[model samples]
Every structure is written in C-alpha cells, then in structure tokens.
Target: MSNSPAQDTLAQDFVAFAVESRVLRFGEFKTKAGRLSPYFFNAGLFDDGAKLGRLAEFYARRLVASGLQFDMLFGPAYKGITLAAAVSIELARLGQNKPFAYNRKEAKDHGEGGTLVGAPVQGRVLIIDDVISAGTSVRESIEMIKAAGATPCGVTIALDRQEKATVTTATGPQEAAESAVQQVQGQYGLPVVAIATLADLMGFLDVQSDAALVSARPAVQAYRQRYGV
Candidate 1:
C-alpha cells in the first residue's frame, strides 16, 4: 500500500478479495443462528496458509488505517479464535507484534486453564471477527470482555451487514446498521468498525459486476428494508 491509499481502497480490496477468496459468498444458506441469508461470509473457509496470510495482512492494514488504540485483541469463540490469532500474527510481521487471546466454547477444567488462552487480557481490548449481522456476537463479546476485567473498545470486521431497521422510508440496510452500530457505541462507548458495508458492496457491484447481481439487488434491498435498524 502507498503512504496514502486511494479513497475506499480498504473497502474495495476487501470486497474484491472477499469475492475472489470466496470466503464470503452469495447464496441461499442457513446460518448457525438459522437465518436464511442470500449471502454468507464463512471465515472458517479461510483455512490455508496463503489465504489466511493474506487475510491477516488486510486485517493489519485495516487496523493501522483505522487508527484504533487497544492493548489487546479478542475473538469470541471458534471462528473468532482463528481470526484473532491470524490478525495478531500479521500485525507482528508488520513489526507491530501485539499479543492476542481467544476463548474456547468449552473451558478446560485443569491447571493453567482458563477461558482465555495466550496472554492475559488486560486494558483496552478490541474484538475482531468476520462480520456483524444482528449484533448478538458484539453484545456477548462485550460482556465477556468486562467479565475478564478489561475494557471492550471496538469491533473490527471484514464487513458490516446492516440488519437493523430505519425510520425514514428511503433509509436502507446501510443506514439501519449505522444506526444500530451507533446505538451500541453509545451504550458501551465501543465502536464497530468494518472494512466495508452494504453501500460499498453496492457501489462495487453497480458499475463493474454482473447484471445478475444488479437485477437481484432488490432482494438484498428488501432484506435491509425489513430488518435494518
């Protein structure tokens, strides 16, 4: 990256790579939470060294570009565990080695065992993950951070799917999610940061992508209309 990246460079690369990596895909799929999504971003698909390595690089770059301040990073469980580890490692490769920790869904009841592994979670902790859908994970992660005697700072994700509803009829998913993320920030003083949002995705798709997505845009728009905050 250059000293000054182009406007929305992070957003563009994230959307492009996400599409290229197929880590996040658009299809009819059932989520763990049982919501039928027209699109899904499965971070678990980031399993190889190259893909994982690139992902961390992007995450690290975004972090630097974001100017977020935090003593540590936290992932929720399972998927989050891997993301946090990779991003922390990538940051280290950039000569900014920051300690990282993650939780196991089932805790080990033995000596030297605790919910969080690796460095002890201390001071301000930023939660990193793939995306924020309904904000459930964000809320739970906040509680867990407080439980560990640390301050939950902000959330960084590859994307932000605005699922909250908006008041103005013209407001779309982006606006709704912006509202929800703001509420969360106001409630806990923590920000939800993402590389891209619906607007970014739409912007990329509108001019360069296929007519299929262009024609199918309304379903996504409808989803935002119904569920956006």
Candidate 2:
C-alpha cells in the first residue's frame, strides 16, 4: 500500500498522459456496475504506435519497480492482447527480456493453432491487462496458466478503480466489500499491481489547472466516497 516517491510520480504522469491522449475522459459515464462515474479510462485509445509504445513504458516501469518476479506474461484476450505484447517488448528493450503469450477468444483448428499464441506459458507467469472490471478476464487467465502447468505470480494492470465490486442479487445489484482488484488478489492469491489508481486520479484532479477538469473533481470525490473500498 506504500508507494515510493518515484511510483507516485509515475502514477501522476500516467494520469496526465491519459488525459492528454484523451484516453481518460471526464464525463458522466455508466459503468458495468450501473454506477454513474465522473471519469472513464479507455486503454484501447492508446492506438497509435507512439502512444502504445509510451503506454507500454509506463507498464514496464511499474512492473519492474514493483519487484514482482515473473518468467513470462499472459494477456487474456482482446485488449490485453496488445498490452502484453507491447509490455513484453518494452521489458526486453529495458534489458529484461521475457516471453509473452496471449489467448484467443475462441480455440482455433488450424496448423500450430489453439487458444494460446506466442511463447509457451511457463514459470511464474504474470497476467497483464488494462483494468480489473469484473475480474472475469483475470480468472480465465489464471485457469489457463495453471492448465499449462505454469505458476501465476501476479497480475498487472493500467488502473485500479479501487471501488467495491458489484454483485447481482435477488434484491438487485449490490456492492461487495472488496474491489475487483481486491477480489482477484483474495480469490486467487495473486498480487494485482497497477500503474495508477482512483486515488491517483483524485490527486491529479486536485492539482489540475484546467477549469473543466477541476470542476469535475467534486463529482469524482463524491463517487469515491460512495463506493471506494
């Protein structure tokens, strides 16, 4: 829970980067949990070559700084596919070469084909993704890693909402005690690391000079108070 100065700075910078890229937008956005959020982070917007390369740098830096050991990276599917590949390339560029693999949404039935692609999953594999929303992707990734006879060391993500997860009940949707990130950590016993979190976004908003962005700070703070873990 204690973040070093460098880590804090990196988080702040990442927030700024997201904003500049228009990947992190301030507006009334409906979440999967059905809560109205003040801001939204869309990692898929890191589309172009330069943006993706820079985004990967942030991920690699945070993972390395966390000191979590992993022999390879596993991207679940869809969004994570690009994230894992880019991060692995960044790590290798930083002189820490590591293999990475990703899963297909559906199993293929062709030459050298299956659900998995790229390097074989082995050893302490780290799951990479954009964020932990419902935690479905992380769960699936863990299952695949174990099936491959690999050990899942931990998970790395771009942002942590840090808000309690929602569960559908007979009464209606209800908030759980722990966030999606927390659920993943507790359920699978793996560390869920992030480059930035909701708290960091709040911090960024506090010092932001943009009149429009600053005006949304109150809404963000209220949302965090209502649902933060």
Measured by TM-score, the strongest candidate is 2
State TM-scores per candidate.
0.82, 0.98
The runs of at least 3 residues in candidate 2 whose Cα sits more than 4 Å from the true structure, single-residue gaps closed, are none
| Candidate lDDT (C-alpha), each | 0.75, 0.94
- The TM-score obtained by model 2 is 0.98
TM-score of 1: 0.82
lDDT of 2 by residue, 35-70 (tens): 899999999999999999999999999988999999
Top model by lDDT, which number?
2
Q: Give the lowest summed-lDDT range of ten residues in model 1.
A: 165-174
